[model samples]
Target: MRITEVEIHEFDYEVARTGTVGGNWVYDPDSTLEPPGFVLTIRTADGTEGHYRGFAFTPPMIAQVTMVAEEHLLGRDPLERRGIWQDCWRALRHTDHFGLGAIDVALWDLAGRHYGESVSGLLGGYRDTLPTYASTMFVDDSGGLDGPDAFADYAETCLDRGYDGFKFHGHPDVRPDVDIAICEALAERVGDEMALMIDSSSLYRTYADALRVGRALDDLEFFWYEDPMHDGGVSERTTKQLATTLDTPMLGLEHVRTGPYGTVDSLAGESTDLVRASAHMDGGITGALKTADAAEAFGTDVELLLGGPAHMHLMSALRNSSFFEHGLLNPESTWILNQGFEGEPESIDDDGRMAVPDGAGLGVEIDWAFVERRRTGHTLID
Candidate 1:
């Protein structure tokens, strides 16, 4: 079967539990948000179609699908994704190729459906369940995850609920003093029973602040320190220095848009102790798989950022990866990840582990009725 058409649907969705907090998604009741959601469909001439529900971005991905890839994908073999991925990768060069994942993932879905296997199985997966960590939103003042005591109390609550690890986004403004205090308090409370981490989100104003917090984390024995520098993790000199200075492993490159190619720099520079890959941010599952393989070759661990079924499928086959980010959660609120389908925390059981979907492809069914009711824009390319 040959490629015939591609379609993109933009829709509206809102949730009380999940909203932007200092660049990280969090469960917050004080914030009411209507973030746009996207879904892409690619159909062959014979009527088989594959789908991808987008997370993390809306417009660039939409533009990449509707504008850049409109005429480029017609009449090609739908299952031969490598060359198609390369074409879009070059086409989107000016914009970091942000929306290639939408195309690449849909093709993977098509392949899985054709082969009668899950996406993980297509990648030769072995494990069925993934251990989880409660990744938190940025520090807040509106009565949730606000201060040291609030964070400590929440960490203990997660531990009681069977979580294996906990991670929190520091203040969006990057307060080293306040961040250190929360780390110390959490260490006193449940650091030994559960692994701990802090994501600075690249908000630190000065290298000194990152150093101070990194020194504190070294003492607390946190699992990892993520994106601590204000330089946006592009400064190889600073990242390498920080990695050597701190005993806590540094997880960097969340902002890097070069796919797996640039990751080779971080590995050679010895800047990052752990690698960051995302199906959304990193080209697609195909690119993320390359990233994971590159990390494994260097004997480093790779972590998938955010939570979603695409990420779950990729991580299931990775031997060097750890933890499904079951996050941006608020214990007192509903965890609405996306509007069209079920996300993590809901799939996570009492044991704090999530099983890979045994069905073919991404193993997700979209709520088309919900999409129709909230439809915003639709594009068709044939």
Candidate 2:
């Protein structure tokens, strides 16, 4: 189907809980909790739509994305996902790649709608159920919880809930040694029961600092590290340094956008063990799929991160997939708002795994009225 129109929506969602890591602090010292997230939605000409939930983006970022989409994707085939993505990248490279992802996701959502297939089907098909890991974000203002206790409690909860593994996002301002000690306790408490990982979230300011932490975690035998540093801004020399010094894999670059025609290397080279590919944030289905392959070429795996039905839909389809990143975000809005799987996946599984929705494309078709009811502003090209 030829594309007729593209629509984007920026809406506000509630935040029931807030999380803190040692390196990055989202918890306002003066506040009670973290702020709600910003979500985006895309609609195509044929009337099909897709959903994207992420951090509240700035006006300039949103505008930059819309401008690129308008210039390059007004009347293209919704199914020629890749070609259309290339057009956006080439057209918008002048603006420093501006949210190249938002536009790509719009197109992919359009394609899934057109094919009447789940976003996962568009990628290589995989097991219906995959393992899920719990990512806890806690802002411990009360100080009642320590790193080890926090990790143990969360990991045990994941085990009780049937999840296969668990990850803890450390308090941004907390000491690295404190965070490491927490990981140590978590490893000891549930090592045999489940896999464990830690998110430094750019806690280490220098490559050596990161290396020291990575080596410590390696001794702990954790799965892999998450976002030890930021994207291209993180020095390649540093990446090489960390890579050589640490046995554990480094994971990140979640902020890169999907290409109308660009590759992962075009954005960031293979410096990590795992790259986060959000179908919604990475240009929807089309751009995400290609990037998954590129990640594999660089010997990196794809961690399908973030919220929404679209994420589960994409995870179900990826061949070289990692775990479904399950976090309890605004459950009051998302789960209460969603007509799909009620509340999160049933549990991890008997095999210590979790699966995707068994239904058709995207599995869950969200109610647009619910979205429109909460609509804050337009993100699409009219």
TM-score (all chains, Cα) for each model: 0.96, 0.80
Candidate 1 deviant stretches above 4 angstroms = 17-28, 342-346
**lDDT of every model, 2 decimals:** 0.84, 0.59
Worst 10 residues of 2 by lDDT: 329-338
Q: Which residue pairs come into collision in candidate 1?
A: none
Q: RMSD to the native, candidate 1? A: 1.7
lDDT digits (tens) for residues 23-49 of candidate 2: 233423333432333344555555766
